[model samples]
Target: MSSRQDEVPTLTQPSEATRRPVIYDVTRIVTRALNAAPNGIDRVDFALARHFLARDNSARGALICTAIGPRLADPDLALETIEGVETLWREDGDAEADDVYRRVVEALGSKGFSGASPTRARKTPNLLYLERNWRAMRRWAPHLGRPLRQAPADAIYFNVTQFLVDRSWYMRWLATRPDVKPVFFVHDLLPIEAPEFFRAREALLHPRRVSNICRYGAGAVVGSQALARRLRQYATEKGRPELPICVARLPVSPSFLSPAEPPEAFGGVNYFVVCGTIEPRKNHLTLLNAWRALARDPAPPKLVIVGKRGWLNDAVVEMLERSVVLRPHVIEAGGLSTPGLRRLLAGARALLMPSFAEGFGLPVAEALAAGTPVVASDIEAFREVGGDAIDYIDPLDGLGWLQAVRDYATPNSPRRRAALERNTGTVAGAEEFFAKIDEFIVRL
Candidate 1:
């Protein structure tokens, strides 16, 4: 026998072997300032902040976080003090940041920190919001600037989105920094899909931003595969390379998953939940019409909407308020706590979210997890998240929605159970998601 015969080749998966363990390193560039619960992306920013602080010895890994404004406070310093994942407190800056943040802070009181002295106080929060856009407003501090100059370079990872304003600054920053592979989260291509929805300048600028994203971003994370596919389609149509995009399902807070006690006003009445900022995109006007058609009988299930009023539809809002069925049947919850939302969902017959478009429908999944049925539009993003679990309807068809509501309202239905069972396989935990994110980070 040859001496070479004694040596055996070792089989190994390099991608698996070289993959990094779960590590949290955020730049603490929060969306919609420190105070707002602006939109889906803003919500995600807060959720991620909580996740990093929740782990053991997490301070070593938690990069650039502060209890203050959008800037990263002392890196090695602040993480050392974070009490729990959910314990981070934030204070409102002066107005250049969106009104949502100020409203959220005043309405919610620093999320998880209520009655906690260091957090609850209006004057001195554990953190303060720095007015970055404040040029003439130097009375606030010496170190204030439009944007922080030096960012801590070495971190496990960073997250960002392609912004329309100050596009050139970020574009230059991203193109130069190959080491800091910003995980750009793709929300939607609404500007590409529905240009009429935006103003002339916005419509032109957004597609350009999307094109730049396809060209420059190192790694891309999308909320749903449908969105990923849509982005890829945009890239292909624009003659750009289809970069490898990761799909991370958004998670509902633990508060919403458990059996919840309903509010006293519910008084054992069945209802359907429709959540999102009321606007043309959300198709609330159409939903109100659908509910009207369904309520021809003495009393139909109430339609509970949980969001604040948003742009582009005054006539629709006026119509909803004046409807015969809507005055009492429509419960405009107007942004409740995660627990409050869960309690509402727990008793709901189903979640009705017949949106015209969505990057991913979050409330639909939340409803499914709560064992409540979903009635959403047949949009690709919803299908990606809810699978065949939801009762799909046309946003344009109020009559179809009426039928869907009737079907879902029926108890002990085999169709509903089947849909629920099918979606269970697609649901993923945070650790699983972190593992996937780690793989992408190591590749960079």
Candidate 2:
């Protein structure tokens, strides 16, 4: 099955029927593509780009915020930038064709999947790409995109990615052009609410981002109901009144949603997976401690941590780098493609996520959507997104997590069977999510 999450272009000849024109912003995706892989927020940005820019939808355009200010990108330039991101993420590639991804899949039902480094280092999409892209953009500036003066009346300036939230100059034009309604997607209030989890600069930057949303935004979008409620409360505390919000639960890609053969049926040692950044907030220490203890078993279930190493986790890095006890049972699979991740999750006994906090637990949802069981932290956001289906436990209760892991790792475990029987997780379709977004725009 293919994933809608990877598609970029989605506009229908730019509607000319006096309907509100949407100026979809792809600035963040364009810039972020030069460095890293797409995260959850990046995926949402791509979805919105597809939704607003559909060839049959409306007469819309794209926006890119430069060092000086926000400027619209012409037709050719916009398409070029989007395609570059699509290609860089391997959105259209054959996952098994790559040896690294093949090993990621192979490790699934084995005693444990040992992660592999690529034989040849992947090419970097660096500054040179950006330099070339900007040059091409300049040449196409006079094409389909027009200046602010020529923009359609009451056009909606929609930016799903919080690309230039800190800078007021990029959005200052909204003050001058009241006809353009500025709508934004607020991914999380994490940096503000959980300041300890992030850097000090981020804590300071988050307030300004939320304040900007309150000061200028006509409407907002959030991934979970818990997050939506929190955003509303935060905005109200900041003196914002009755902000219109659209609560759209993020969708799982088709790769994860498709049915897969369970690990129990694969006739191999059962393994479990933990997905997310290796940071303090993710509570990797607890999992590491638990895995270290599990390693004493004759054949402990393998623990595959699927995500790139993130910031501010010296202890996590230390343990990963130098724990002789952990070497046999743990695999740091940080760079598997989307399909590879889906396969890994599908064959796992359970998706173990003991995060300290989250705006939305996408991996938990992905696991359940794939018909894989989940052992998650007992948090409000997880409760809302995963409901009764999750095997919820306190993030700090070492004994509880240890016992749950032991049970899930066992073959033909009754607890796992019961949980899967009662699981109610369903992946939302691409059109279903976009339909809600469309309705939100109409109401706005």
Candidate 3:
């Protein structure tokens, strides 16, 4: 690898359409577990890919698949490859089979599969699930052609999700490619800023990822201006003061825009919903404790937690599993469909987001777009996206959160009325978001 430079290249004039084919990196999506639903990053990846495919005739965009580990050089994934994957992703792929496999995996993992003996008998069900998905993908693999031997000199490499950042070898190899210009979309610097919230390995590796972007990327994109400023500071600190940065707001997906009836789970009762993974930085504990305090009310508002369990959140998980007072009021609606989540948000008294930190509060934006009230942390990112439309509070202030929740729960509450009045419509959509990106690419 070349020595780290203090300067990076600036965006040049627009190139001819044929010379500037945008190659989107799909290493993350291609390798995700088949049964898993799309998360924040996943949604961004799919949205960008879908937009490119929709405009294939007008724009020169292609999806390229790259492996993360040792054997990094792989052929470009064909257009049909993305189509097949999108089909499975959108439909959730053989629901019954996925459910069965998920149950088996969950049951085994809960039973200490991590420490289980390396015996074939113990691995049978796990292997069976993998084999089934493998065979299904194999049937579609033939339709997706092999990767290309080389890319064009002026091709642009766009990585929206920052996949494989820890594997510096692969990223460095791509960076050194004289023919392609690499651009990365940095979601956040949380791992570097608040290392305690993430695993030790990630805390160690994330700095390298930022360093790589500063050293080799043609430019960087951020979801909010707050993140853009953070990246600039990091670049200056690393002695790469010339790094180019762009700020583009992420779009609320169309699914979140549509109106729907509340799901039957609510049972005609008013509830507050909190979306996102159960993790330390999310501050689920604060909400849990507040709900515990409110349990004394004969008719306290229900709390709905929508997201799967994430790493480093054993305390929150324990509370969810064992707290008697929380049992009746809290609903763990993990694996909710996009439509289901939209309805839940639409019907909620308010969406409670007491996250200690955030790159971009998608759920908060989604809730506001759905005309649902929001009671969130007074973080910069939330302030950027939500402005004064949300009821902001200090993430650590449990009493403040309880009061906000209570105000929203009361019928004809002034806070709730104000939030509803401020709901003009959906803020932004995929088209507008991608248009900004496309313009940025053109300028590059």
Candidate 4:
């Protein structure tokens, strides 16, 4: 591994065909900055942007998907947008003074701080930054000093986020720019595999997303080999069986890799955390039910559900708003920044993820990286990421989840003790992840 750096090829001139230059499609991360709803895919986009922009070569550009069509953002504006998104997303920093972290700590110790802050006090994103950037890009139609008659040619455009993959305009960008080769970073096939857990429209739209990749993509990248195999199968189903694909085994962000702040002992307020959107597929109902049953205990550990609310969540919302018995034990701290999540996970009894399906179960790896134990469902993705370091249970086994949470909450339970002993830090590396992408580019 020490000498692999010298042996590895770079994306700049990996092969004869792709030596022209690179153009990253980073529309998703820019828009995500305004909403503060960044998930795994957004992280991938940000990482890719940073990786490319750091290179000494100045030939690269970011293709911004706009209302009219795709607009090419020159190097300077692209760097500004990438760095701005990094700051807005709270990707760098400690949790010591973070508003969300303090809020979570306060909520755990006091009944007054239920979960989310008052609607009036909520921090609305400063839109002025985006407005300025947007205005600047509107005038950047010439593609890096190129004449209006000429277009950026022989470039590899990476669509890491499936933002507008299914749209006709998105396809048209490729149709018109035949010299550009399209590559995608596919996160999952869960929408197609587990339609019951998603809204009807997601199931309908995902096929088109897959079709776009299969039909036009020069190659594809996935996090896990499990996903790589499934993506190949999807391509075969889409009549593009020979599609080029690579697996990089998703890299853990540096923010999570840093040592987590020591867990604050606030009046002995012990709790666990479940990190994901409050949607049906995540199987939050199972944990809610388990916690509801735990309410009978004289001193039950708390559960912090960390993620924004997602679609088709009437039942989850109803339970959250109406269940008085579970109120004392649950906190829904949605839209938490990375540092805030790190602090919360550091102090948690365990990170609970009983999702029925996942593409790559990032939260489990994140929890483990925080030196926190995870009690996840026995799914392939979790197994791939966590291996035997964390405990796994059936997502459907409500009683099993209840028992595991109860045992993990104990001061010296064997499961929790074993998991903590097995924690050896994160295995995912940024260099390795990009090395795989570089090799894939060589093949392309």
Best by TM-score: 4
Error of 4 at 164 (Å): 1.3
Q: Which stretches of candidate 3 lie over 4 Å from their true place?
A: 1-19, 53-133, 136-149, 263-267
lDDT of 1 at 347: 66
Off by over 4 Å in 4: 1-20, 56-58, 111-153, 263-265
Candidate 4 worst ten-residue window by lDDT: 115-124
Which parts of model 1 are misplaced by more than 4 Å?
1-38, 50-73, 76-157, 163-166, 199-202, 236-242, 261-265, 410-426
Model 2 CA lDDT for position 273: 86
Ranking by lDDT: 4, 2, 3, 1
Candidate 3 lDDT over 1-444, as tens digits, reads: 111221223334423332356766655655653644557877777777665554444344453332323222222333444455444444333322333223322322231122222211111124544555566455434433333334545667777776766566666556456677778888899999999999998889889888888877887887887887788889989887767776668888676676656644445566788989888999999999999988887677777777778889999878877776676666665554565567567668999999999999889888888888888999999999998788889999999999988888888899889987876665877765765676566556
Per-residue lDDT, model 1, residue 76, is 30
The CA lDDT of each predicted structure is: 0.55, 0.73, 0.68, 0.75
lDDT of 1 by residue, 149-254 (tens): 2443533334444444225543554444455444566778886788766556767887777777667755566777667667777776766544657666787645
Q: Please state every model's RMSD to the true fold in angstroms.
A: 10.3, 6.2, 7.7, 4.5
TM-score to true structure, per model: 0.71, 0.87, 0.81, 0.88
Clashes of each: 4, 16, 2, 0
Clashes of 3: 2
Ranking by TM-score: 4, 2, 3, 1
Clashing residue pairs in candidate 4 are none
Once fitted onto the true fold, the runs of candidate 2 whose alpha carbons sit more than 4 angstroms away are 1-18, 56-58, 105-146, 262-267
